[model samples]
Target chain A: MGIPIYPVHLEDPKLQGFYDGLAAGELRITADTETGEWVWYPPEIVTGRPDATLEWRTVAPIGSAYTFTTVVRSLLPGDHKAEVPFTVVLFEPDEAPGVRIPGVLVDADGIEPACGMRLRLKPVRAGDHIIAGFAPAQ
Target chain B: MKAGGVAITGVGETPFIRGSDDTVLQMIARAGLDAIADAGLTPADIDGFVVNQYTGHGSDELAHVLGTGERRFAAVADSAGGTATTGHALMLAQLAIEAGLATHVLVPYAIRSTKPGGVYAFHANEPHKAAFEMPVGFFAQPTYFASMANRYAHEFGMTEEELAAVPMTYRAWAALTPGAQKREPMDLDTYRRSPMISTPLRVADCCLTTDGGGAYVVSAVERARDMPHPVVAVQGIGLAFNNWPHGVLFTQKPCTFEFPGEASAQRAYAMAQVGPDDLDLAQIYDGFSISALVQTEMLGLCERGQGPRFYAAGHGMPGGRMPINTSGGHMSGGYVPGINLLIEGVRQLRGQEGQRQVPDGGNSHATTILARN
Candidate 1:
């Protein structure tokens, strides 16, 4: 509890489903009910049109690493020191278009990741919070 | 004539130093008082105002302490990053003058980046930071920009020395600047040897988190004629928001390295009635060294994918084909938000930068860029 960091308040009404999905080991995102567009990072409403509703859709738990960085230094205080030199990646799911999400590349240290390398989602618990991450596809 | 009837009459700033003794209020107030005095006006004459976020007690506290009359126009600018803060502050002040809301307007920006909690303060505050970004270990701005720099280098085959030139030029310029924080002369060797903050971003490539504040007085063109210093005209201005998804994450793009400033720059140039060729110098925001390169390209200063080559060819240096970040920019000048760059633009236009002055003492026209990532 060095910095008192907390995960997304799944307790909130708007984001309850996203957190519940993570807790349940299901990866969910939103798609336009009208335009058939997949939205990553789970938008509350369809982009650009407030009147349109975004429907929750369960997505494949696998993606490809689009781009990433190897953090050699720790910028944050506390338990982050042990996490130095970890890899953070922006990944594109196989099902989404123009939508990418970010997460730590679990167990990716010493691994030279090439673009389009397949990665699968893994949700782990930190303190009382559940965080999403990715591991190289076996 | 982008937004007419406005001219920057005076620019002032407290020393750009790391771990300064001044409090946030003191830093901003000192700069504001100096600017108002430089404009040859008093607090009472300042009818309009805008300031970057310091805390809740911003506009009213400052106005009261300055002993000003009825506050005709006073508001705080926040949420947007540094560049947008500067642009919106200026635009709001411009609108105040043009719409007869106020005769003279004041815009002030200050940051205590060197404070123990300064850099990470936004983590808990930005609505999305605490939950989505910080929990995943994306704790600071540098890592976010570093990803783009890495991708850009990989895609374009930009050599390490070419990337090194970005900070190298700024450090050289900063040496000439008296109060600049990192003014020591830096050669390619020093930059190459600097510690890596993140992959593809060395320590020198990131902006110094120093404490400082800057303020500017904007007056009608008629009032500018009667002022003491040469007029730094607000010739043109433009602003663009993160229209794409995920804001700074920029997940909407097939290539994540691109900056979204093309539309903003085009709009500003259109309003100014000048193209990139007509610009004498640019003070584009350099929160990260690579951002300046991307912004210069997006602003049409050079062709896309030519930024690395442009700097490597000895452009953007003093007396080079293109003059950029002449006052060391945020890298050396201290991140006084983006207002310090605006101050540098005014100083260059007025032929006031002593050693770092561009050739021709700044041509007949000048443009200072404030771009958000």
Candidate 2:
């Protein structure tokens, strides 16, 4: 399976921290500044706390696959024919319980991907940018 | 009855076709006219309208298109997707009729899947999706649902054959349905032969793409007796939202496959003063095999995690104890969302669906349950 290659269009500048975290070789997630509680996918208003500010903090890369799927057909906006049959997994950080970060599973030659399978963060460079990637942790 | 009762008096739909030259408005106009006529009423009789927000049309627009006079009530079903078409639209219509805001209310919805940008365009516009999920190639409905199917199988136990049974069950119904988009016979082997879009989810496992429109009229149950068809009362309808926004829906739910429909089912059953066992048949919005089966469990049709096995046991098929989607659901019939399923329910109550009609138990009553996330 080839690496998925697609442009990351960040409409909200707040999300740039995620990609920045990746560039710095770390898995970062958003949390409310006051409570320091994890809020995933980075919603604009932070639920009920309009006054709360979002802060990105690097968490332990070791986690387990919450759920995953192998995309035999690429449904990205443009043609991604070369990136067929890639498994996209929702990974839960060891520190965060409900927070899930979506990424493509990597470096599992014979290890079958399943829910709760141990994995570690391994950022992968597709075309021009790096995206979240998880490799099986033995 | 209650609140003078609001029953679905008339239903109409354009043919389920792969592609149509007609604009969305044109299809709505045609279907609207047919539904009014089916109700044994003229355009002048319809004074209230409940329109879908996705259709991008207003009540004033429908009035202009249908040539209706003196519009008294107009509201939009903001509940997006199939829920808007089936659940929310019906609730709005019932509210309008009960409030005496309008007499005859029309609910219309149409989908042009082949339109430019296609259906995924809406998702693409989601800023969170663009920045986070899309870059990883985890976009598209099939991919999203496929992931859920895999996780559901792991947690709840679903075999390959069990998953195939969902669409296969619906296809059998489609074979008997005249205007169904796909009516071909599909056995287990045939299902195996179908191309896989994502693992465990073949093309057959997903909802069909078609350009079609369906409309229904709702009026007081007392007035429905004067109409053309049997009075299929809106016995009970309960709509529930888990409160997950579109951006976080796929990834953030406590259980990724959870739709939170059990609450809705309980409310519906209470309102109708009936339970799951009391229904003669049911019509579920089958957008994908996974979500359909999950909702089936939520509706208490079978034990939790037994939706796939329910079909594998042939319970949802023809001559089964509990028939579901008497008309081919979205998977086989056509993907005009929930409106077609609503039309099919009304048709079955009228006992007009020749070969596919569920056998009546004297007076026909079907409890339709559908949910979307």
Candidate 3:
């Protein structure tokens, strides 16, 4: 099946770094310039300080498979309908203790997914859009 | 003047079934009319309106049909999910009545999402959906709950038999409910034969998508005593949000297999000046059987990871301690989101549930907590 273009809102300034990093094959995160707090999902401001400066920080792509589920039946209409039994994994970055990110576990279709398995980011082009996912780290 | 001084004077619900010929708007009107009648009040008495935000059904439309002239308060509960909507509405109504903003507040919830293509395409249009969720094929509601079930099973050593017993318990209660969608007896054998919608979650584990509605009439506790029905006090009210970012998939939750129920219930119980031991019956939200278990656990009815065993042992059945979802709950009772659960809670407290009534009902509470991504 041909890869379909899933819509991504790059117009959001808080989330612009995420999409840009995916396109660049890097996992970019937001960190507080003043408090040194690492934010996995982008936010408008730091934890407590609205005046704290924020900047994009790149971390190692390696993470552990926190938890996951297999979609045996497709709830969507388009190309996803044909992609049944695909594994969706939530990975916990080694650098970020509490933050967890969700993505598809690419490759290893017949392999049963296990918790605490090591994985790495694998951003690839799907049609005109870049989709980010995770694969077992070498 | 106190927060818990408000009361649910009347309760009404449209038939919970697989298909309804009535439109959502018509159902809302009927429920409102029935509630007003139950409360022994005229439509002119209602000056406040609250509705579920999902249907885009405005309070003005409801107020117009109900003849609630010159509405003083009109609002919609947050449509985050089915769990917290009812609580949010009741809390708002209580505040309005306490603040002297409105005398009688009408809260009604209606849905037609069970029909063909009605609920299957319920995709959240948040900025996060397009980025994380949709691309991974986590489209429907069950997939998210299924993920929670899998993680719960792995972490807590939840057995398949334990999981299957939940629906069986609800079916036993539903058998007594006349208007319930699934009245057939569902034993463990039947549950095992059901197909898998997702891993660790079978078809029997999910809630019904009924096209129906439910409504409640709220007024001052003093006025409720003089009304037509028994006064069910709006005792304790608590709300907790898990701070999970929108569009984050279920697996990425800050705490999987755990809702903010502990904190919310603690606040509610404290406000009511009652603990889990004080509750005689509970109308727990059962969007899925697992959700019911989680809610029960978090409510302090049983220890964590021991909910399935507690439910299976008949403690939640009629005539048992802490009878739950006596109206069959969302699973077998026809899911009108969480509004029906609230109505049932009031019914139990009022001794209105005929055969399903808890024997000499004790302090009753209706509550739901959901942490969505």
Candidate 4:
């Protein structure tokens, strides 16, 4: 039999906002917690602090490229064909207490993602799914 | 500096190989025997046993194979990979010594490379693995680290040339280590063009997978004084975890220097009463080049985001401020699990590195801190 699939449930409002932002065009969002401010991924409660105050706030989508890697092979099936190389990048947003976000590069040609290149987060719709991606800032 | 100290008296390792005919049981026996012999003890003296469960070898089975008369302690630790193995082993040895549970403990790992078995299957069962991660084809560790590597490069303005410098420098040290699997020098251009297993990481950036075992014996300092080798003391150790929420995948802002590593280093240095400047040599784990860089910063050797610059400036090389991974490390040295790094640290402290020895000469005192990513 194939692997069993489980539906992930998100209950926290902050986390819900994070996924909602991903679904919408808001590629970058920040969360302020009592321990400290952080960015959400598969969002949830801030770790360590028992009484963490997490709030979802939107910010500028522009970020500076921190690092980038080109993947020649897909780790998952149907993600990308063998010929199409995928570029994964860590983009540092231009906000206070700079946050690093990981995403894929879309529409990047000839220009290789470098350590300090500026890029903008581009949220796209894959069928009905919302995914965040990075492209060189014009 | 005697609040609570443990002594590492004996270290042994099986030669790393691409493929081996020996079963996991056989590897454990061989490595365990060598470690006990290194400690100048017999199986009767081993009161405790510690091993990594993920390696597929069971701790109870290992203790039975070694023929311990009446074992006082047996532990199969998870969560700590290579560096954690050393830290946990030392911790258990110290506890046993103090608690009157057992005087001697053997920590061994027998992992078979080239054979895809054991915990690799467990990854398929993880909730995250089945859901968001595996569906994206992020099957193995390379992809996870590749994502981080890309982010590190984009955030820090680091270059492949700069990134390639870490493995290149490690290979130089490995060249001096006769036991190293890949001892040849690696040039930058060759490193840059190396097969890209994942972006920001190349074939060279990753640690080699090999079949081997590394084991060490620990005992109280008084008991170890009678042994042939000088004792390498475990001065301090610390561990932390990244509790990033799932949806915040890309934005989990972990400070390489500040999180588990740096915090752990601070505790270790405090316990040892030593600072980064006092380190005669180090055996930082190099599972990946960025891992080494992150660890160096966390260990207080350099400032945040300064690891690449420190490596680029040749500060982490053999003759530099703090000679690191003198045993060739996991990067160039065959990965016999992580016990080799600890063994190398002990060897460096004992002045056994020979040509790979640091220029400042022999070291009577050393501290080894192991960090897992």
Q: Which lDDT tens digits does candidate 4 get at residues B42-116?
A: 888888887787667776777778886578887766655664576655666677777878778888877776675
lDDT of each: 0.72, 0.84, 0.75, 0.67
Estimate, for each residue in A1-138, the C-alpha lDDT of model 4 and write its tens digit: 012112223333334564576666775455655544663443333455545666667777887766555667544433355334666666777873456665666767778667678788786444345445667898
DockQ of each: 0.41, 0.87, 0.38, 0.26
- For all predicted structures, in order, the TM-scores are 0.88, 0.97, 0.87, 0.79
lDDT by residue (tens digit), candidate 1, A4-80: 23356332255455556678887776677788777555554455788876667778888887777767765755546
Clashing pairs in 2: none
Better of 1 and 2 by DockQ: 2
| lDDT for each residue of candidate 3 in B44-110, tens digit (9 for 90 to 100) | 9899987777767888778877787679988778745555446788888888888889999998878
Calculate the i-RMS of every candidate, to one decimal place.
3.8, 0.8, 2.9, 6.0
Q: How do the residues B1-373 of candidate 1 rate in per-residue lDDT, one tens digit apiece?
A: 3444678887789998888898888887888888998899888888888866653447788887666657688766764555534577787788888778888888876777777766766555544444455666665667777878877876776788888889988887788888888888889989978998777788888988878888898888777888988766776677776555443354446676675578778777777666788777787788888888898788887898889998888788887877887889888778876778888877887777777877564332223332110
Model 2 segments more than 4 A misplaced: B1-4, B361-373
Q: Give residue B252's lDDT in candidate 2 (0 to 100).
A: 88
Query: Highest DockQ among the candidates is held by which one?
Result: 2
lDDT of 1 at B87: 72
Per-residue lDDT for B116 in model 4?
59
Worst 10-residue lDDT window for candidate 2 chain B reads B364-373
lDDT of 2 by residue, B288-316 (tens): 99998998888888999888789889998
Q: Sorted by lDDT, highest first, which candidate order results?
A: 2, 3, 1, 4
Report chain A TM-scores, every model. 0.77, 0.97, 0.83, 0.72
Deviation from native of the Cα of residue A3 in model 2, angstroms: 1.0
Candidate 4, position B61, lDDT: 78
